[model samples]
Target: MSEAMRKPETNGAPPVISVRGIDMVFLKKAPGVLDGLARRAGLPRPEPVGVHALDGVDLDVMKGEVVGLVGESGCGKSTLGRVIAGILDPTAGTFRFHGREMSEMSPQERYRAKVAVQMIFQDPFASLNPRKRVIDIIGEAPVVHGIVPKAEISDYVDEIMLKCGIDPAFKQRFPHQFSGGQRQRIGIARALAVKPQFLVCDESVAALDVSIQAQVINLFMDLRRDFDLTYLFISHDLGVVEHIADRVVIMYLGRVVETAPTAELYANPRHPYTQALLANMPRISTEKQAFGQIKGEIPSPLNPPSGCHFHPRCPFAFDRCVAERPRLITKAPGIAAACHLLEEAAR
Candidate 1:
């Protein structure tokens, strides 16, 4: 298989973007006087807890590769995406762009890095400015960054809009005047205007209809082919991930539990979390795909279970699973999984 089709982890080339030991914690503030009033009025009171959004996540994105990031809601998929796009800085850990530490980069270097890595947000309605015309939204950035002269902005905007399947005629319309799919295309065009080499697509198609989703996905494939862009596609839909990704990264409770070439991971998932997620996804064939029941609710991240975060819900939990967290270790060529029982499973 071509290097682009294989697991990117096995590639000797240094990653275009590398993330190491990323940990993010959100402090849920204590209840204010409103909480006391609510309690007095027999209303439910909010509990304060430090929500751990991500936990020691390590990931790498090779140039010219699409890596799917999948996990349940609140599992930190979006957080990781934002961190990679420089939208949010990790509370702890290191992010490197082209072998240089992101946090240590000079202001000029940082601006260049941020422009090179752009994000496509999920909700088009909220992401696009309702009041501004589409032309301004997409054209202003490139002109401000000196990517194009003001006199040429019109042609440049039209070119980008056309590439993303948006009509150049609609450039004068506001975001609210466009349909959901058109709005999303506008968002894509805006990202493309920045001349980004990497894109962090955080559930970029989840809100669109199934048919629209397919069209957008195909558009992404076409764009990738044309520009050699790298994508970090984050989604909860395994089906979509299966179709769009060359490699898949499975995260749980802010930590990556498994990563492998798309087909291999789906066929032979080592981590129990990955197994359960795959089993839950609807399949067209009736070949009995149930791996095992993933019992128990996902424990609260505020005070997650000791040792492995997934241990409480894992079917094969043992003393070690409850005492020490397992690192994501290589299991085979082009495959890696975080599970203490990998050796036993191999045997």
Candidate 2:
């Protein structure tokens, strides 16, 4: 088999999806001209700052592998996912699927690329249309893309609905008629309608109850096996990622702090940010151990701290961390971390 068709192994095929140096910036609306003029006359700058949603973020997802993206709220996990799905264009970056540049693709080409990459949003209720029936919702993609004839739309929708663990009869029901978990299942069915090769699940299970969360997660696992799907699973819940992710990426303040195999990351986190994140996870153990406590609120993206963005909260931060930004360097085989401390450790 060709490299692109091969499944993920320890050191196997190149990434099916590759994102490099992605930077997404949102321009904040400036204040009135009068305010700006006043600011120019020996006052604070009145010009609106640019919000850096993603700052030079890099990631790779191999075919048929589940990669987890974990971070605090507003840490750019969802923004990255949207970029990968081609729903939101990045301010500056390269996104490639099967070695083809996603940004340069034509409309038809982009549509085809989108067919291969799909997204499952966080809020089930918000994702689905209130007026549309479940059948229509799931079949909309295939119909627009001409994947199936109008006569066969219902049949195709029924097949995927069943595959996603939803009853065929439930297709006629509106989204409001269903519970949170069921609504999520319907959303999954919609994404599956296109028979995507890659899935970007943005907090897919966060809204459901604990028991229901497991069921939804299991459905995702089963669907992956049955459909040969690769996923970019984004979540704030480290526990859920531990259960499903093959590799995990830790994000803080719009940049990746660390990336490692699931077991390796949980076992030994190199970056102080990663260490602090893992240390705070809820656990039952009463044993005394050194735990790094996260301090201070995340700085606003519009005016983020210079040098190391995490320096304000990182206990191990030093003068160099405040003066120079760190690049992600491979600290171990298949594990990379962005921290000045690692350079000393490596030497």
Candidate 1 worst ten-residue window by lDDT: 1-10
Clashes of each: 0, 0
- Each prediction's TM-score versus the true structure: 0.89, 0.90
What digit string (tens of lDDT, one per residue) describes model 1 on residues 121-153? 999999998889999999999999999999999
lDDT of 2 by residue, 1-347 (tens): 24343337536556889999999987776567877677778777645667899999999998888999999977899999999998999999899887778768888887898788999999998999999999899998898888888899988988998898888988889999999999999999999898899999999999999999999998998888889889999999999998888899999879998999999999999899888888888765777766547788878777778899999988998999999999999977779999999997778
lDDT assessment of candidate 1: 0.88
lDDT of 2 at 270: 89
The pairs that clash in candidate 2 are: none
Whose TM-score is greatest here?
A: 2
- Give lDDT: candidate 1, residue 229: 89
Task: Report the Cα RMSD per candidate.
Answer: 5.8, 4.3
- Poorest 10 consecutive residues by lDDT, candidate 2: 1-10
Question: Residue 117 of candidate 2: its Cα lDDT?
Answer: 92
